[model samples]
Target chain A: MTTDDWVAIWLTAKLATLTTVLLLGLGTPLAWWLARTDSFWSRCVGALVTMPLVLPPTVLGFYLLLLMGSQGPVGQFTTWLGLGLLPFTFTGLLIASVIYSLPFTVQPLQQAFRAIGARPLEVAATLRASPYDTFFSVVLPLARPGLITAAVMSFAHTVGEFGVVLMIGGNIPGQTRVISVLLYDRVEALEYTQAHYLAAGMLVFSFVVLLGLHLLNRERRV
Target chain B: MKNLTLLAMPLLMTLAPNVHAAEVQLAVAANFAVPMQKIVAAFEQSTGHKVLLSSGATGKFYAQISQGAPFEVLLAADDETPRRLVQDGQAVAASQFTYAQGRLALWSAKQGVVDNAGAVLKTASFKHLAIANPKVAPYGVAATEAMIAMGVYSSMLPKLVQGESIAQAYQFVSTGNAELGFVALSQVYEHGRMRSGSGWVVPAQLHTPIKQDAVLLVRGRDNPAASALLGYLKTDAARAVMASYGYVH
Candidate 1:
């Protein structure tokens, strides 16, 4: 691959890494609340958080563009905070990917949290353990597999995302042109050989991540 | 079982014309939306045949047509696509003609953002400058050409935001993500005047003529309606509509 090709790969990895990190940090609390809470409003909020999984990524991006444009409320808020508008930039792309891939992260974490059961936390509470102590000491350790799955899923999904990235990122090389967008550009330009190479690379990368997760799960089951 | 028969009766009635009904599919480019919408209406009014239209980027449409989508007519953003379609036997030979010439403009929804000379790009007042992807969209190619001619390609490269098509490029500026973007002039025109947005119409000398072309695909050769629309595009009435929308003869 050329230097430009490597640049795309690097940017894709960076974007995926940042998106996964942000999703994990933000998703844990929300996923916990959804898993533990029984309120009707909590379920509604949970549904809204997972809404992106059902939306076509391009449609989601279209809405996001309006929400994150200069005149949009979110954009105005960001601008007031000195971050500028949130479309057509690398940072903007991260925000879009995080929202787009939220369910991939949150769903897995929620399932994991639920699997841990409330019995452990309740027992810890009886033993005079604080909520924070029980969470860090008991809950988090048990939910490691779920967190890993969520992170890997989020990262991989972010890397593979095309429609939303194209809609919001604008595919500027060395800035916002991630690997998937570059692959699309190659195909559109009739550079089939380059497209094939990039596509194959992505296929292998995604397979490796998924295979690792499945192997871990198998070992745990064993 | 009595209710089942009642439902089957209407289903059978609809399926009775299986041999007589034929659908003519047309793959249209995004920029040809207005003119093609009119032509389709007129053609259907005169011929009494349905035209199923699917509009998208010309590059994607070309890829689909090459893969043997059942599209009978292709209204393309550039002449090259129709020529390629004909050469590949996806389209009828000698059935292609330049239907309209497209115009490109640097537009901004923000007041006074785009001047007539387009000097704003050089100063880099805009944090993002949207344009269609030059490798795929014809309007993008023109936008790049205009940027190159104006000596802003390098300086603006860092701020460049490339859309898959002119439609999305317009969306970028219209949504105010980027201060301005290169768009089809037709997108910003209404009734012989430019819309509320500021625009700098790029000089023709900056780029190759965007000669939009229409071709009857291989499947369309036998469809009378498809042929009629292709012919209708050249008529005075159609030409006037195209002209009003900033298309050249």
Candidate 2:
């Protein structure tokens, strides 16, 4: 691959890593609330969290573009705070990716939290374990599989993001141009050989990652 | 028997158009979308042939055409892509002709932001300046050339934000994201003047002429409707529409 290709790959990796980390921080509490609550509001919030899975990436990206633009609400507020515009910046892409990958992190974690039941928490409570202590010592250890799954899924989803990134980021090299966009540029420019190489590399990498995930699941089950 | 008939209904519905009126699949560049729609409407009215217009970046259409896309005609944003198609034996060489000359404009949603001389480009007032992807759209190439001719290329580099097509470049400016952008004249032109935003029509001498070309693909060699549509594009009615959109013939 060319230096440009390498740059795109590195940028994509950085974007994916940052998005995954941020989503983990944001999604965990949301997922925990979703699993514990039975109210209509919780259902509504859960549906909103899962909306990205069904919503076309371009549609979400379009709204993100509007929302993060100079004339939009978020933009106006940011301008008031002297942060400038968000579109076409790395920060804009990171924010978009976090939202786009939210479901991937949240859904699995919700299922894990729900499956834990009240038995472990009751046992911890009987032992005079504080809520924080129970969460750290008991809940986290039990939820390890789900946490791993959420992190991996979020990372993979962000890495493969294209439409949303394209809509908001506008393809600025080293700032917003990720691997999928780079591949698109190569195809448009008729650089078929480079496109093929990049596509094949992604194909292999995705296959290996999924295979590893499956193996890890099986190992934990055994 | 009833179930089988029900299953075949949707298949029939999909095939019904081909069995009825003649249809021509046209691939149009993003910049020509508005005028192409008007031209297609007129052609359909006059000739009774249905035109299915698919608009996108010209480079994408070229890639799709080279890969055996179903498009019978291509209205390209640049002369070179059509010529390349002809040279590659994907299109009829004889059918290729310049359809229109596109105009580039520096547009802003806010009135009076852009002067006639395009001096706003030299100032660093706007953090983002939108332009189409130079590798794909001819208007973007013209914008780049104009910038270089004005001796502001290097200075303006940091503020550049590229859209996938001229249409999207217009969107960025219209939405107030970039503050200003280089877009096709047709996007902002209505009646005899710009509709809402201020625009500076870039001088032709500053950049290469954006000569849009139309050609019949090899797949359309046997399709009469494709040729008829191409012929209709050159008529007075279509030419008038093009002219109204600031396209020169």
How far off is residue A209 in model 1, in Å? Answer: 1.6
Residues A74-115, candidate 2, lDDT per residue (tens digit)?
989878889888889898899999999999999999999999
Give lDDT tens digits, candidate 1, residues A29-99. 99999999989999899999989989888799888899999889999999999999988778889988888
Classified by CAPRI criteria, candidate 1 counts as: medium
Candidate lDDT (C-alpha), each? 0.87, 0.91
List ranges where model 1 is wrong by over 4 Å.
B1-22
Error of 1 at B133 (Å): 0.7
- Mind giving the per-residue lDDT tens digits that candidate 1 earns over B71-95? 8998899999999988988998789
Residue clash pairs of candidate 2: none
Q: Write the per-residue lDDT of candidate 2 for residues B130-197, one digit (tens) a residue.
A: 99999888889999999999999999898899999998899889988899999999999977799887
